[model samples]
Structures are given as C-alpha cells and as structure tokens.
Target: MEYISFARLIEAVYLPQIIYTVIALTLSCMSSHRSSTSTELLTAATVQVSSDNQSPNSGNPENTYSDIISSSVHNITVIGVYMVIFAIAGNLMCSYFSGDACTIISTYLEIGGGVPVLYSMDISTKIKTALILSLTAFGGLSALFQSRDMIRISGLSFIKYTTGKIVCAFLCFIFYMMCL
Candidate 1:
C-alpha cells in the first residue's frame, strides 16, 4: 500500500481549483488596471478633442474614476463566468473520485469563488466562501439529499433541513445586499 500525503491529496484534489482562483484574482486585478489606464487615456483624449471649448479638467477626473469602477465591474463579470466553470468541474470531479471531503470542498469553493466575482464590492472572499461552506455542511448534516449520504450519519430530518436552508438563504441575501 502507498501513502498519499495530505499535501499531495490537497494538491491532487484542489490543484485546478487553486490555480483557477489565483488566475481569477490576478486577472481581475490586472484587467481592472489595464482597462482603467486604457479607458482613461482614450476617454481623456476624446474629451479633450471634442470639448475644445468645454472644461477638459472636469471631464478628465470624473471619467478617470468612472473608468476604474466600470473596469472593475467588467472584470468581476468575467470572473463570475470562470467561477461557474470551476463549479461544474468540481461537481464532475466529485462524481468521478468519490471523495466526500473533496466533493464538499469543491462545492463550497463554488460559492467562495463568487466573492472575487463580486470583488469590486466590499465583501471578502473568505466571508463568501465560508458562508457557502457553512450552509452546505449544515444542509448535508440535515440530509438535504438523502441519497447523497453514501456514508450515513444519523440525526437529520427534512423539517430541520428546510429551516436551515431558509435561514441560510435569508442570511445570504442580507450579506449580498450589504456587499451591494
């Protein structure tokens, strides 16, 4: 028998996820900066030419801030698509590998990944991911999907689950609005 190290297991299980996250975060930052710079330069130049008799100084500053916000929002949308893709991959990985922890972690990451997608806002990724994970674990413990209990642990019922899901959903909405 061979020993599979925990680090190696984590890598094998989470490698694609980790890589996707790093790329998503890095690309969001880079894209926002690049787009902001390019948009500002181009917008300013256009404003200068078009508003020859108008206040170029006023237009420049406003457009600069707007450019940053717009670019950040654009990057977040792109990252959202990436997040969904990773979630799909994680779901498929769980299907094939049959590892409970890996499957659970993958789904949790799916929601956690949303933070960066909404990163232009104030919510931290840790908060987003943790919220998702906690809700998911709470659901599983309550047996949201009875068939999914390949390794059955007791003390769960449907009423308990419905209640938890409702509470979690409300909490998610509250946090979402706070981010907004």
Candidate 2:
C-alpha cells in the first residue's frame, strides 16, 4: 500500500481550496468596494428625504431594525425553499440510477455521503485520488446550495464563482497528476 504523509494529505485537500477562496475574496472585495460607493450615494439621498419629511416612523430605529430582520427572514426562507427543491430533485435522480452510476451522482450531489461510496469502490488509486481532489475543489451541489445566500449577500456573480470552482477542480486534478 502506498502511504501518504499528513502534510501531503493536508496540502492535497486544502491547498486548492485556499487558493481559490483567496482569489474569489479579493475579486469580491474589489467589486463590492466599487459598488458600495454608488450604493452609499443612493442611500444618502434617500435618507436625506426621510430626514427632511420629519416622518417619525421613517426615522424610528426600532422600525428600521424590524424591517431588516424581516427582510433577512424572507431571504432565509427563499434559500431554504431552494435547498428543499434541490434535495428532492437529487433524491429522485439518485433513486433512478443504480450501482456505480448512483454512486457517481451521489458524489456530485453530496460529498459527505459520497466519500464512503468512493472508498468502497474497486477503482484504481489514481482515479480515486483524482476524483477526491477534484470533487473537494468543486465542493458538490450541497456546497453550492449552502453558499447561495453568501454569494447573494456578497453581490458576487454566481456564474463567475462556479467557473472559478471548475477551474480550481481542473487545477487540483492537474496538480495531483503531476505529483504522481
């Protein structure tokens, strides 16, 4: 059996994720900073109108706080609905497939559930390693679902983030192949 050191395992598992996260965060911060200037200007104009009108409710901190809380709850409800729908669809698909195909689909749906499946597969070590690294980089559909709220709140483009994940997965696969 081939033995892998702890450092190597950590590098393989975390290096690509860290690299992708750093790049994504940098891009997100730059874009948000640019957009925040415009948003701040618009907000200032609106706030000035509320102040000039001398509306008690408009300036009430408690009302504003409640509004923010309600909006957050709405957003969370929407995300939860999306997650439920996705889970249902994934379950239906998984039920439709059998054996290896089902395992592969499950892997793309939920990484945690799929890892044991991967371990039990009678596949070559290289294929297993590549799949593990690439899947970890891509983070599966569950990760996408979990990150949807964060992506929306951050004002980051979903398409770009997904593309980055694909690129990172490819890079991880390449890195693994190179190490062999």
Candidate 3:
C-alpha cells in the first residue's frame, strides 16, 4: 500500500483548491457587469457610528444589527436546505450505476467521488490523478445547481453558465497535462 504524506496531500489537493478559489473569485469580479453598491451603505453607517456616541440610534443599533444577522442566518438556512436535497437526489441517481459508470455519476454529483474512483481504476496513477483533477474542474452538477440558485437574482443567463463550465473543464485538462 502506498502511504501518501499529509504534506503531499496538502500540496497536491488543498493548495490547488485555494489557487482555484482565488482565480475563480478574480474572474467573477472581473466578469460582473455591475458591482455591488451595498458596501457604500455599510461604510457610511460605520463612519457615522464611529463619529458619534450620541447617535440617535445608539440605543437601537443593536436591533438593526440583529435584524441583519437574523436575515443572513435565514438565507443560509434556506441555501443549506436546497444543497442537502440536491446532494441526496444526486447520490440516489448515482447508486444505480456500477464500476466506472458509478464513479462518473458520483463525480458528476460532487468531486468527492474522484479519489475513490481513481483508486479503483487499474490504470496508471498519473492518468488517475489527471482524471480526478479534470472532474474537480468540471465542478459537478450539484455545484451547477447551486450556482444557478445563487445567481437567480442576478439575471445570469443559462448559456453563460454552461459556457463557463466548458471553459473551466478545458482549463482543468490543460492544467492536468502540464502537471503530468
């Protein structure tokens, strides 16, 4: 049995994820047609609150804060519910397939299946690694659904979403080839 070190796993897996997250965020910000104006309101409120202890809402600022916090919590809960349902349904659909087909289905649902599938394959480790990396780059159907739900309020088109996924997958394959 091959024993992989923790550092190797971090270097190969965690570091790539961090890099991908940074790149994804940079791309998202660059691609957005309109930037959020909400930050201006928050900055103004912070300046005002800091400038005066005698502010009119000094006694009720906590109430306002609590309202914001409560709303954020509610939004998180709703999103969590949606993700759970999506994962459950995807897993159920994947359960019907076996061997490589099962691996592909599970990977389509989430990237978590990639490692197991890679291990199960009789192919060379290098190819297995590439497959896992490619699967991660695809971001799975579950991720696509989540993205759709999140962007529902932003008027993002389905065509754009699919195009982005295709571009990402292509980049991932290139990255895998470079690594190999």
Per-model tally of clashing residue pairs = 0, 0, 0
Best by lDDT: 2
lDDT of 1 by residue, 1-180 (tens): 224355643343244344445765587578877657656766765666566435455568787687779868876666666566666776677678865455544554454543233333334554444344344333322233322232122223345445545455444434433432
lDDT of 2 by residue, 87-108 (tens): 6666677788777667666676
Q: For residues 41-75, write the lDDT of model 3, one tens digit per residue.
A: 45665666567446466579797687779868977
Clashing residue pairs in candidate 1, if any?
none
> What residue runs in model 3 are displaced by over 4 Å at the alpha carbon?
1-63, 112-123
| lDDT of every model, 2 decimals | 0.48, 0.71, 0.60
Better lDDT candidate (1, 2): 2
C-alpha lDDT of residue 66 in model 3: 76
Candidate 2, lDDT over the whole model: 0.71
Task: Please tell me which model should have the higher TM-score, number 1 or number 2.
Answer: 2
